[model samples]
Target chain A: MRILEIENLKKSYTTPDGEILTVIDVPGFALESGEQIALSGESGSGKTTFLNLVAGILRPDGGRIFLGGEDVTALSEAARDRLRADKIGYIFQTFNLLQGYTALENVLLGMMFGKGADKGFALGLLERVGLGDRAGYKPSQLSVGQQQRVALARALANRPALVLADEPTGNLDPGTAGKAVSLIKEMCAESGAALLLVSHDDKVLGNFGGVKDLGEINRAPRGGIEK
Target chain B: MNRENVGGIFLIAKKSLAQHRLSTVITVLSVALAAGLVMAVFSIRDQTYDAFTGGPAGFDAVLGARGSQLQLVLNTVFHLETSPGNIPWEMYEAIKENPNVELAVPYAVGDNYRGYRIVGTERSLFTDLEYRKGRKLTLAEGELFNPEKREAVVGSYVADKTGLKAGSKFNPFHGLVFDERQKHAEEYTVTGVLEPTNSPSDRVIWIPIDEFYRISGHVLRGGGGTYEPRAGEEIPDRYKEVSAVMLKLRNPQAGFLLDQTINRQGTAATLAWPIGRVMAELFGKIGWVNNVLSLVAYLVVLVAAGSILASIYNTMNERRREFAILRALGARRGTVFAAIILESASIAAIGAALGYAVYALILAGAAVVIRAETGVVLDVLKPGPALLAAPLAMIALGILAGVIPALKAYSTDVASNLAPLS
Candidate 1:
C-alpha cells in the first residue's frame, strides 16, 4: 500500500554573493495509495522546494527517495525522468500550457511526451475533467478555473500513480477552489492515486487526511498563514 | 515512440505553426527568396550553354580564306556575323573530297533583308541539317528549288514577317555591308518555308550561290549589264568569292588535325573551331572576373547560413519556456535538442525549395528575354553539377543553424523550471 518514501532529504542553493543556502531537510516520510497529504508552510518555508525534490525535478545534496519501493534518488537524471514520466503527474498553480496550443492540444501535449497514451484517450481524459466541449479552445480562450481543469486533465491523462499538485487552486475563488479540490480528489481517489498537495491554504489543509507542517520541523515559522 | 505519438508531435508542430501565421509566412518567404536565387543562377548557366551549342547544326569546324578566326567561326557556326574573307567554292569541294571529312557544307553570307541575313548554300543543307526533335526542312506549301532554278528557301521568320512562303517571289537585297544595290537583277520564287529552328537559321533566306552572284554582279554594275571596276582599279578577290565553308569531320578529333593542316600547309586558308573561339572570347573577357564573382557568391551563401543561425539563436530565447514545459512533461534533454534541430532543418528545407523554384523562374524569364533581344537561344531546363550546389549547401547550413539551439535545449535545467517563475 505504501507508494512513496523519502529519508534524510536535503536541498541547497547558492546565493549571488557565494553564500550556500540550505533550504529543506525532511528526515523521513511515507505515503500509501489513495492517501491524500497536505504540506503546509508559511511564505519562503521551502514548500515548493520539497515538492520539486520529491518530483525528481531537483537533485537533493544528500537523500534517498523511494517511489513504489524503487530507489529513485540513486538513479541518473535521464532514468529519473523516465521514472517520473511513467509514474508521476504534476499540476502547477499557473496551468502552464504552451501558448499556441488549444486546451485539448495542451492535455494531449503531455501524452505526446509520455510512452503509450493515444490521442483518443487524451480527449477522453479532457471529457472526464468536464472540458470536452472546450477541447478546441486555447488556454487564452479559457477562464483561469477552466485552464486549471485542463492542467488537471493533462496531469491525470497518463493515469500516473502519484499526482503532485503545487497550490493548484491558489488563484481561484473559494467556490471554484472548493470545486477544483473536490474534483481533483475525486479523480485521484477514483484512480487510487496518492496525492501530495503543496499549499498554505488552511481550508485545503483541513480537507486532506494526512498533514505535515514545515514550521514544526524547521523550529521557526517564517510567516503566519491567513485565517 | 509509437506512430500515434509521432503523429501527435507533427500535429502539435503544424498547429502551432499555423497559429503563428505571420512568423511562418516570414520564414517561408525567406526560404523562397534563397531558392529563387539558386535556381536562377543554374537556369541561366544551362540555357546559355544550350542555345550556343544547339545553334550550330552538326558543323565540326569552319574553313575560310585567311582572315579573322573569330569572324569565320561567328559567320559559319553561329550565323551571327559576316566572314572577313571567302574560301572559294573550289576549296570547299576539295575539303568535301578528303577521306577524313564526313560531310562539308558551304555558306556565302553577304546580304541582309530588313536585318535578317540572306544565306547562299546547297540544297543538301535543307536535307542534311536537322533541328531539335530530329526534324528536317519541309515546305508548308510548294516544292523545293532546283539547282538551275532561281528559287529561295525562306525561313520561318521570313515567311511570317514578309508573307513570302513557298511560291511567293522577291528581288535580292543589295549588299552584305551596305544594303544598297543599284540594280536588282535576280528575282526568285519562294520554293520552301522552314519550320522554326529557334535559332539564327530561323531568320535566314537560303538561295543558290549562282543566283546570289547574278544579283551581286548586276547590282555592283551600277544600273547596267556590264560589271566594272572602280575607275581602272583592281577588284578584291574576296569580293568575287564565297564567304566560308562549314565542314563536318569523320571524327571530332579531325578538328584539331584540320586546324593544324591549314595553319601548317595552306597559304591562304585557315580553320576555325566555333567552341574554341567562343570560349576563348568568353574567358578572355570574364574568366578572371568569374573567379571574383564565384567567391562573392560563396560569401553570400555563408552569410545566408549565418543569418539562419542568428534567426534560430534569437528564437531560442522565446522557446525557453516551451522547452521547460516539455522537460516537465518528461522530455529528456536529448529529445528537446532533437526537436529544436528538427524545427531548424524543416525551415531550411522549405526555404531552399522555395528559393530554387524562384531561381528557375527567373532563369527561364532571362532566357526568353535574351533570345528575343539578342537572338541567343537558351534552354530553361538542363541538369548540371553547378545547379545542385545550392540546395546541398542550404541543407548543410540548416543543420549548422540547428547546432547551437540544440545544444542550448540539451543544457536546460528541469529543476529550475518546475516552480513557476516569479
Candidate 2:
C-alpha cells in the first residue's frame, strides 16, 4: 500500500529578472507503507522542494499529492496544514527545535496540534531516543547530536504515517552523523513510518533500504535555480 | 479553539516571552509607567473635587461685604482667603432674626495666629454651626469661649502647630500679618481646643467677637482712640461690625430666595452658596486644566501602545524562522497569529496590573501628605469604573498593536525559512 504518492507534480518560481523558472516537474512518485528510501541529490536539485511539496508546506502549481489515499493537493492551505499535522512528520537538517522549549517540550509541540498529546507518551519517546535524562535541557543547552535525537523523537511523537528527513545529520561531524542516521532509521522502523531521507552525502545514503536520485525524479532543467 | 488548545497556546506564548526576558521586561515596564501616570491623574482629580466641594461646613449661604462671591466663601467659610471687607452688625442682626434663617453664625476674620486664620464669633458658633450635616463642634479640651471674656478656642490644626493648649495665652495680631509690631497689647487666653473635623475650620483660632472688635487698630465707626472698652465702658451697637454671616436655612429652598433678595436689594452683604456658585466657579476655571492633564496622560498611554508595537514588530524578523518551524510542526497560520496576539495582550495585561499597583502605592504615600496639608482624605482602596476600564483599554490597545506583527507572522514563508537548512 502506498503511504505517499505524487503525480505530474509541477512547481515554478519567478525570479528578480521577472522570468518564470520551473523548480520541480516530477512525472510520478510513490512510497510504500513502512518503506524506507534515500533521496539522493546534488546541491540545487529540488530535493528540499520535493520534501516541502510532500510536507504540504508549499503548494505545487499543478499536481496531485495523495497522502494515505487523500489528495492533499486538492485541499485548501489550512486543510493541507491539518493533514500535515495529522499524517506527516518533517525533520530539518538544523533540528529546528524552539530554543525556548525544553527537549521534552519540543517533542510535545509536535503533538500540540494533534489529538491525545500526552506527556507520558512524549516522555516515552524522549526515553526511546536516549534523551530522557536531558528532557529538561533547552535546544541551546544540547549538543548537535543530542539536538538531532530530540528532533527525531519529536517527529515521531504524533505517530505519523510518513517521516521526511531533510539531511537530518548534515550539520553533524562524520561520527555523530553516523550515529544520528542509525538512531533515525531505528526510530522510523519502530514507529512503522515510511522514511524519505534526502541527502547529498553518499555515506548517509548507504544506510537506507532503497535509493533514488532527485535528478532523475525531478524533470526540471538543470540550469535553473531549484528552490 | 478548544479550551485545552487555548491553554497550550498560552503556555507556548509564556515560554516564548520568558526566552526574551530583557525585551519583555522593558516593554512591560514602559507600559506600566504610562498606565501608572494616567491612573494617578484620575485619582487626584477625583479626590480634589471631593475635598473642595464636600467640605465639612454644610452652610446654605455665606453673606459678606459686596465682592467676589468665591472670595467671600473662601475667607468666611473655608478660611482660604483674606476678608473681602465687612458687613455691619445690624446686617448680621437682620439675618439672625429672619424667619427663613434656621441658624446664622457671625464671622469676623482679620487676625491670624502664625498663618492660621483667627475668626471671631459668639459662643453660638460652637453650639449652632453645623460642621458636617448636623454635627456640631466638639471640644477636644476645656470649654467653649465665654462671650464676656477675652478668650480663644483653637482648632485642632492651630493646637498642633502653635502648641496652644486651653490655658495658653496668645496676643492677637492687628491683621493677618504676624509681625511683633502688629501684635496687640492685650492677650487672649485659650479656653478650648476643638477636635479634628478634617475641614477648613481645623486650621483656625476662634475668639470672642468683642475682643475681635477691640483689637488696637480696629476702628469703630462712631468713636476713635483705640475704641477699647475699658472694663465697663459701653461699645455702641453702631460701632460694631462682623466680616460675614454664615446662614443655614430652615428650608434649603429659602437659600435661593435669600441669595436673590440679598443681591437684588443691594444690601451691604452678598449671599453666596458655597457648593453652588463657589464650587461651580472653581471647577469651571480648573476643568480645562484637568482636561489638558488627562489628554497628556492619554498620550502617554498612546506612546506606550506604540512601544508595544515597536517591541513586537522589531522582533518579527528574527522570529520568522521560529514561526516557520511552528508552521511545519502542524500549527496553523491562525494559531500562530492568535499566539502572537495573545503574547502582546498578555504583556499589556501584566503591565496594566503593575501600573495600578504602582498608582495605589503612590496614592498611599501622597494621602498622608495631602491630609496634613489640605485635610483631604484620599482613599486608594476605592476603585472607580475607570480604574478597571483603563486596563481593559490598555489590553485592547495591545491587541491593536499586535495586528501588524501577527499578520507578518501569519504570512511568513515556511519554505523559504526551511530552505536555509536544505
Candidate 3:
C-alpha cells in the first residue's frame, strides 16, 4: 500500500525586499509502506521545506497531499495537526527532546498526543533501543549519540504509517552517522512504516539503499533563503 | 479530548512549574501574604465592632456627673480612664426612682488593687446583671459580696492574673495606679470570683458601696472633697457621691426619655444613650487605619498578580522552542495556551489555600492585643467575606496574569522556532 502520495506540491515566500521567491515545486512523489528512501540536497536548496510541506507543517501554496491515501489538503488546520500527529512521525536534525522530561517521559510525550500514553509500551521501546537503564535520564544527561537514539525511539513511539527523517545524522560524527542511519532504517522497516530521510551529507546518503537528489527533483529557485 | 489526553497539558504545565520552582514559590508566598492580610484585617474589624458596640451588656445608657460621655462610659463601663467628677447620691436615688428605669446600678471608683480598678456597687450587680443578652453574671466560685461588709468580688481575669480567688485578701492602693507604700490601712476579702464575661467587667474588683465610702482617705479625698469626720462616725449620704450610674431601661424608648430628662433638663448628669452609636462613631473616626491596611493588602495582591505575569512572561522568550515542539507533536495551540494559564492559576490556588494558615497567625496576634487592651476576646476561627473572596480573587487575578504570556505561547511560529539551536 502507498503510505504517502503528493502531486504539484508548491510553497513560496515573499522577501522583505519585495521579491517573491518560489522555494518548492514538486510534480510527484510516492512511497510504499516499509520503503526507505533518502532525498539528498545541497545546503539552502529547499530540502527542509519539501519535508515540512510533506509533514503538513507548512501549507502548500497549491497542490494535494495524501497520507495513507487520505486527501490532506482538504483538512482544517486542527484536523491537519491531528492527521500529522496520528499518521506521521518526524525526526529532526537535532535531537529535539524536551529538556525537562526524562528519556522515558519524552517517549511518553510522543504517545501523549496520539495513542494515550502507555508507560509499559514506552519503556519497552526504550529497552529495545538499548537505553533501558537510561529511561530515567533527561536529554541533557544523555550523550549526543544516545540523545539521537532516543529521538529515533520517540519518532516511532506512535507507530505512525509514515516517518520523516530530516538530516537524521547531521549533528553526529562520521562513525556515529553510519550507525544512526542503519538504526533508523532498521526501526522503520521493523515498524513497516515508509521512511523519507533527507540529508545534505553524501556519506549519510551513501548508507541508504536508494537515494534521490532534491536539487534534481525539486523545480524551484535555489538559495532563496533557509529559515 | 479524552480525559487521559487532557492530563498531558496539565503534566507539561506542572513540570514547567517545577522547572521554575523558585519563581513559583515566591509567587505563591506573595499571594498567600496578601490573602491572609485581607482576611485578618476584616476579621479583627468585625469582632472589634461587635465587642465595642455591644458595650458592657444590658445597659442602654450611662448616666454620669456632667462630662464627656465617652470618658464616662470608659471609666464607668470599661473601668478605664479616671472618674469625671461624681454624681451626688440624691441624683442616683432620683434616677433609681424614675418611671422609665428598669434597673439603675451605681458605681463609685476611687482606688485600685494591683492595677485592677475597685468598682463599688450593690450586690444586685452580680444577681441582676446580664453580661451578655440573656446571660447573667454567674459566680464561678464562692458567694456574692455582702452589701455592708468589706468583701469583694474578683472578676475572672483579676482572679487569673492576681491569684486572687475567693477568700483571698488584698489591700487597696491610695490611687488607681499601683504603688506599694500607698496601700490603704484596711484589707478587702475576695468573697467570690466571677465567671469569664469576655468583657471589661471581667477585669474589675467589685466591692459594696457603703464599705467603699468608709475606706480611710475616701471621705477627705472625695469627689468634692468633704470634711473628715471622726473615726467612728459614718460618712453622710450628702458626702457620699457615685462616679457614674449604668442604667438599663424598661424599653428602648426609655433611653431617649432618660437622655432628654437627664441631659437636656436635669443638668446634674450626662446621659449617653444607645451606647452603640457612640462606639460606632469611635470606629468611624479610626476607620482610616483600616482603610490604609486594606489598601496595602490590595496593593500586594496586585503586585503578586504582577509577579505571576512577569514570572511567566519572562520565561516565554526562552520556551518558544518548547511550545513549538509540543505544537509539532500534535498539541493544539489552545493546549499550550491552557498550560500557561493553568500554571498561573495553580500558583494562586496553592498560595490561597496556604493563606489560611497566615490568616490564623495574624488574627491570633490581633486577638491577643485587642483582648489585652479592651478585654474583648476575638474569635480567631471566625470566617468573613474577605476570607472567602480574597483567595478566589487572587486566582482570578492569576488567570488574568496568565493571559498575556499564554497569548505569546499560543502565537509561537513552529517552522522558525523549531529550528535546532547551534
- Deviating ranges (above 4 Å) for candidate 3: A69-71, B174-182, B220-236, B420-422
**Candidate 3 lDDT, A140-225, residue by residue in tens:** 99999999989988888888899999888988999999998899888888988889999988988888878998877888878547
Fraction of true contacts retained by every candidate, in order, equals: 0.40, 0.49, 0.38
What proportion of true contacts does candidate 3 retain?
0.38
Q: Tens digits of per-residue lDDT for model 3 on B1-422?
A: 76545788888898899999999999889888887887888788888888788865668888897978888877877777888888888778888899898789999888898888898899878778776788988899999998878899998988998999989998888787878888888888999999998888888899988888778877633336675544346767666688888888889889878878878888778998788887788789899998998888889889989999999999999999999888887777888898899999998899899889899999889877776666778887777787898889989999999999999999998878886321
Which is the winner by lDDT between candidate 1 and candidate 3?
Answer: 3
TM per candidate, chain B: 0.79, 0.88, 0.92
Q: Please give the ranking of all candidate structures by lDDT, highest first, separated by commas.
A: 3, 2, 1
Worst 10 residues of 2 chain B by lDDT: B222-231
Ranking by TM-score: 2, 3, 1
Give per-residue CA lDDT, model 1, range B351-371, as digits (tens). Answer: 777776777777778866775
True contacts kept of 1: 0.40
What TM-score does candidate 2 reach?
0.92
**lDDT values of the candidates?**
0.71, 0.84, 0.85
Ranking by DockQ: 2, 3, 1
